[model samples]
Target: MYTPAAFRQDDLGELHRQILACRLATVVSQGPSGLQASHLPLLLEPGEGQFGTLYGHFARTNPQWRDLAEGAEALVIFQGPEAYISPSWYPAKAEHGKVVPTWNYIAVHAQGRAEVFEDGKRLLQLVSRLSDHHEAGRAQPWAVNEAPREYLDAMLRAIVGFALPIEHLQGKWKLGQNRSAADQAGVRAGLAASLDPRDRELAARISADHSAEAAP
Candidate 1:
């Protein structure tokens, strides 16, 4: 993450919030063969370690977990709201025609050595917690115990759980902070006018970041 000073996000709480908001993460690790990546929905334990701990599972057939079992450090990426910002949205484009197109997004990177396990009890608990967290907002939330005991046990055996206590966490919020206030406002206005929900989300993030910056 090559973050400029203006885009750097160092607040631990905010970083954890982003991770929670974007539960699915890209886990990258180096194995005996080479680099491998896995997309998994990770649960964050915010108070577990200096930064925090991440809990997730990989399919038993997935070789990436084998790498983690052998002590490979992992890099987990949590990507948040993002949108394409046209140069036309910047007021400076009209003033000096110097602006170029850019992307506005938020992301967090967590790095640490991962601890892998296949114990059925721990795996059951991990899956249950992960399920409950995601299902909390549903009208008819499901639970692991709802399924037949044998089926649930078989499902749990098909995956391997891992815990990574984050040693280093970095967040990057590239929401046009380098641009002039007028340009940022223009971007917000342009994005808010779009029908795409993602663009509107980015607009809201920009507004929030700007308000935080202007706050006393």
Candidate 2:
């Protein structure tokens, strides 16, 4: 990702937080046919490698896994809160009429060579962990063993698991950091008052980023 100095996010903890908050990710790899992309919910093991390791699966019928089996490097993209920024929200628009419309968003990219696996025992464990992670907030969390043994085994066999130890990690938080403080405050006020919940989320991120910058 091309990120300006003001928008660059290099903190490891912050990168992990953004990745975890955005559950679903786009995994892209080069295949025999061409570049292929798969949307999957990935689990992050933050302590696994220099950066971290990602765990996820693909349906056995999906050809993307076959591409990954070739040892080609993969890129995983995690997108967080994003919103459109109107030029009208900038105080500079009124002062000099120089501001133009843009977008504010947060995103993280992870790259590594993927390792595919088919071991039934490992598959079972991966499914169980994935289920538990997403179900933890439910009133009654579900487990993999709840289903019939044969059925669960069959379901597991239909999917292929992969591990990618992140070799490179990059985060971009474009929340109008290049704008003047007054203009940023104008954006915050405008977004915070909007009806869209996503706009409100972006406004909150702007506020948080401002606070972080102001901190000594």
The parts of candidate 1 lying over 4 Å away from their true place are 208-216
lDDT of each residue in 1-216, candidate 2, tens digit only: 999888999999999999999979999999787999999999999999999999999999999999889888899999999999999988778888977899999999999998999999999999999999999999999988899999999998899999999999999999888777877888899999999999999888886448323211
Score each candidate by Cα lDDT.
0.91, 0.91
| Backbone clash count for every predicted candidate, in the order shown | 0, 0
Off by over 4 Å in 2: 208-216
All candidates: TM-score: 0.95, 0.96
TM-score of 1: 0.95
RMSD of 1: 2.7
